[model samples]
Target chain A: MIRAALFATAALALPTHAAAQETPNMPAATSPSPGVWIPRMQARAYLLENDQTLLEQDLRIEHGLARDLSMWAELPLYEGFLDAPRPSDGEFGLGALEAGIELRVLQHDLDAIDTVRGAVFAGAALPTATDGFGRQSLDPFVGAAITAIFGRHGVNAAARYTFVTGDTDLPLFIGDDGEDVIGADLGYAFRLAPAAYGEERVAAWYLTLELNGAFTAEGDREVLFAPGLLVEAPTYAVELGVQLPIAQEGSDRPEIDLGIFAGLRLLY
Target chain B: MRHPILIGACLCAAHLLAPSCTSTASTPTAVTMSYSAEPLAAGEHELEVHGMSCPKCVSNVDLQLKRLPGVDAAVVDMKRGVVTITLSGNARPSARDLATAVSDAGFTLRAIDRGAQGGTP
Candidate 1:
């Protein structure tokens, strides 16, 4: 689950998540290099627009379907929104469910060419997390991005626009669908520790700057900005960071939200 | 000022320019081995140290030992949890240096076996 606090999303704000931690989340749907394939459990907390926050933990399975493809399925083990009305007194309800796939179109080994390969990616976010917290019936989004790598530096720029049916059976919640969403990211990573044994893992530490904006199909606009960090090891990795909303328009929602995310993947 | 394109471009430029400053010449790794100041006997020594977990760990230990001023090569079979370091010419790393490198890598060297010692070969 993309936890609320981890992503720093406000309760009332739209979904403006952080950088592409996954290669599927990589530069794009093109040429991706062989990266670490990690499987583990993760948890994150989201700060919504209403000053309310929701934290979720999930058993997540993220597999690098291919150099340019990643498949992930997350099942919620628990969920709690700090500011939103509690769904129940105890942990008994269908939580927001989600599953998705990310595709990379281009990428290359910077080590060989010394030039980081560029890439593009397209993917969809499914409404798989249960509707317990804020999971709507359907949330289908499409996005594209490009990434460039320098020796120990790089940037991944992505734009994602999700078209929601604006049809959550629930009324108070307006799904992000119909809200043309766009996210652009800039990130850099340096090798804190060089891979001397086995094969070299890509960059060791990565920091990302991300900005996302959404203009409703109806001409309403809202934007969000987020940044985060990541550390990679041979068979495992650790990451931590926060997201803050920078600009907002055409909405009654607050202009800012906050969240935190962290996880590691074991490369096969 | 959200200039990912500009930022990406600059980064691409830096990545391209960095190697030029270092010298178009690739770093040449010299494969010459020298024995340490102190030479070891043809036999073995029982030495206790740290840092040896998996096969990869063994590789690092081997890399460290083989570069010994006097030692020639080292082999670590992680499954067996043993490392065999051998040298022919002269110069040998002090037991302290060997133990330190192993410990720094997060492993312990329980013993060093030459032929006479009973440690794992």
Candidate 2:
């Protein structure tokens, strides 16, 4: 089955570079190039399956400290069936707490409508969750990301590795073998509205497609294709997307049939 | 299995329905004046900044410039990529300071004019 903690961690792993510049399922390496200090808040919900329904709500906050540095944290609350047809009432509680920092290593503004950037990030997941929801250990992770923007088209890619510290006897999802986890994602976003840039502030709409993959040291692999829509203003954004598993190989847990997510982000 | 075609159709529908939500105008013309590294005088100053394509970009430049000492206000003409800064009395912020502020906001300061009147110098 889908482990609530693992799902939550994967969903909230990366920090956004700008107010609404990131894709829904992946991180953007671009820094907050247009703001000195921008703080952002996002509330996201996900619905997925193992053999039963899994619903999770994630709250995230990010702050840009400088032109090339940013930090973020996330907390998740989950409600779902922990097992197949067991615990008929279902279970509800908090998941792991994760925090991270990203530093832009390279940024080149090619012109008014084109740019490239790269960043590296590191953080840890703290074991602060209700029973049957957390790893009960501190997990450290590191990753790098890159972004490129040309006119109305943008690309983002990131890869991360997380080192699981402890093991549990509970019917865990992935990483129960104390093996590390690896994840990678690539996303493309195309501006669908305001086909061109102008003087006045306008709400921007984007169509995004992404490929997200996860692998474990114990030969578990899963790859999902996610397509999403985003409506972004200067101060806030609304996003909705759905994920479909295209590949599931050697997975020790239940296969994920489908996943849906929606989120709202506010910038200050 | 999930219906990929259905999801794609929904996304397309959403985009098509929102065609009139935002303007589709092209980029505005920008001032192309050159600036010298001379000392800035107290009063109003205009700066030509580069790589500002959105309102948020203008806001960032405005906020950073206003944070500088003696800067009373900063107004951005996004179409022209020019920022007009009002300086308080006795404010002697140099051209380098203005450039630095723009750089800190993730853009480049291309030119600066000391007075409100436009001239080629």
Candidate 3:
């Protein structure tokens, strides 16, 4: 059952929830390259009650290199507390550097309805962390994502699989929860503001919900439901969300009672 | 420990300062003047779109429309929420196809006006 879910998500290849589209009434998880450069800094913190805290600061840049192709790079600083009972043994270091390219696969327009968009992407994560905080070796991943919009409602789906290459015998870290990992997310976004469109730079708000899951080859699976609010201006956006674990099984990984994500994105 | 803080500070400063440096280009006066009233070429169609609230939304529309198989060019008018699409030689898409592309980009197709040059038969 875990493998099946993994495969299903791997096939979808959805975009990260942090990369919402700038357009109103669009899905928040599908990355859209609007023929321009987009630079985003995302700060994420995860807290496990009585367990650990994970802090991530990522510098991400994406550009539409061509009409149908876009490339992106992400540099992250990760700070997290592992399973150590001592309070001071937590680790902080540069996390994996990731780079990827996405190709628009399908885009179609309906006569009286909204449009549909699809894309496929492939990327690699390079080990750059200290003290086993990241995958100690290079990890490659590929996935597909699709989005559909209808007036003020939109839905997005994505699946991806990462081929892990880390020292399995090393001491475990919170980031080392898996060997091969499959991840997927299903999200819906509803426009909350801007009952009517405007000509100048418009500020729109959206209420979003996402079902996200990660499946590991080691039989560990973690699933969460996240509800968020997104605000978009002309060239920037701010998003805030909370993730609550719905199901967790297998592996000794401690369940996160609650997690929060706040992000800011900019386009140029 | 200080890296995240430093970066955050710098980003915050940039975000606050960018408006002063680049506000003129996106001003309402500038946006209204950008509406294209140019004539469409043969096999061209114009889509009066809805719900495109910003320049980024216009870009999204352009990106998705140009991804269609037969499309050669897509121009989005942010001022009017209009998109002009041109088809390649001997290629065409139905109204449904156009609507689907716009919808996929998270916009509505309010109207499709055939180009004055000629319609695809």
Candidate 4:
């Protein structure tokens, strides 16, 4: 009876937030809070292509909406690495931006836990990444994810589906200019090294190594992998790494697209 | 940074078949187009370059290679301990310099197979 009441309250309070399909990135439904700290903002980018030499860039921002949930938007910036008089040298345009949220279903710090830790997430992403960048029109999507940390080992898995409704532009990656969008992210992170966290003057410091591989539901049937290190402090963290595009997906041109990037993730 | 929540779901299907992925006993799976067990080659050595054990090491290696002259695109086959280079216009590599680059990036140059004889650019 209480669960039904809670559902009713949620339905009336947040109707649009309800996801059509559950993605691993999206956690189970939950309430919202201002968060232990203020919401944070992050910027990250990626350069991708096939062996054919095609190119694409991704610029994105992610922010936490609550303690266990964070919202994000991504824009597939700068494509056409092969275009023109150095087409690769061009201005920044609208990249595919997605407005979605991620929830942390489970959170625990166990001393004897080794590396066994599991957390779940799921949310909705409105195709806000941008229609101008050849991205799809306004569409709604959903996804879910579960990740665990065991000993020095870390593992995660997730899936998502984007339903097609409004105008259709057949987004890139997918072979068709169709009416739907599908995406998934899976990988792992190992705490190869550990650093300190928080101080009297600061929150903390943390250092660790990681590895990850991901593919999407669209034309990108690729097994993209990256390994790198991260330095985390109380207020923020920095991650440096590169992408190795060893696999190709769909009609996506095949080219050796490589990139070196740094990212800022803060919990402000 | 946080361990990406996406990786687990993406490789879940495969992990079911190869549960030994992170174990010392784990064997490198089919990573090359030719599908060879002893995949590492000479010009480049990739002997299960352990120690990294994370996604970031993959990125670090890519960064280390781009700085090389002859190396056009250095694609690291993470799960396979292989690094494939797309050389440009007869870009020759000095084994000593190549080894240093790999070592500085924090990995072992198990082997380098001049990459496939022919595949698109």
Q: What is the DockQ of each candidate?
A: 0.02, 0.12, 0.06, 0.01
Off by over 4 Å in 4: A1-33, A36-81, A84-89, A112-132, A164-176, A179-182, A195-220, A252-256, A266-268, B1-121
| Candidate 4 per-residue C-alpha lDDT over A1-268 given as tens digits, one digit per residue, 9 for 90 to 100 | 3432342233223111111011112222222221212222222233544322223333344444543456655544443334333234333345445666654443332222222222233333344534324444454555555544444455556565555444324334442243354554555545433321111222122222223333434444545455555554333445556656656555433334664444454332
Instruction: Give the interface RMSD of each candidate.
Output: 15.6, 11.6, 12.6, 18.1
Can you tell me which runs of candidate 2 are displaced by over 4 Å? A1-20, A31-47, A65-67, A84-90, A170-173, B1-39, B42-46, B50-55, B69-88, B113-121
Ranking by TM-score: 2, 3, 1, 4
| Superior candidate under DockQ, 1 versus 2 | 2
Candidate with best lDDT: 2
Chain A TM-scores, all candidates? 0.64, 0.83, 0.80, 0.59
lDDT over C-alpha atoms for residue A197 of model 3: 51
- lDDT string for model 3 (A75-179, tens) is 876666655632224455777788988766554444232556666677888877665455567877777778776666768888877767664333333236446
Instruction: Give the per-residue lDDT of model 4 (tens digit) for B1-121.
Output: 1112334543464345234323311111111122332212324333224333233444455666667676667655433455666655444455445554554443444344435452111
lDDT of 3 by residue, B7-119 (tens): 46545754564465244212322322333333333476778776554445765677677777678888766555668778865455666666656655545565667454443
Candidate 2, residue A121: how far the Cα is off, in Å: 1.0
TM-score of chain A of 1: 0.64
State the lDDT of candidate 1 residue by residue for B27-86, as single tens digits: 110101121323456444443333232223333455445555766666554323455566
Q: State model 1's lDDT.
A: 0.43
Per-residue lDDT for A247 in model 3? 81
What lDDT score belongs to each candidate, Candidate 1 first?
A: 0.43, 0.65, 0.61, 0.40
Fnat of model 1, as a fraction:
0.00
Model 2's lDDT to the true fold? 0.65
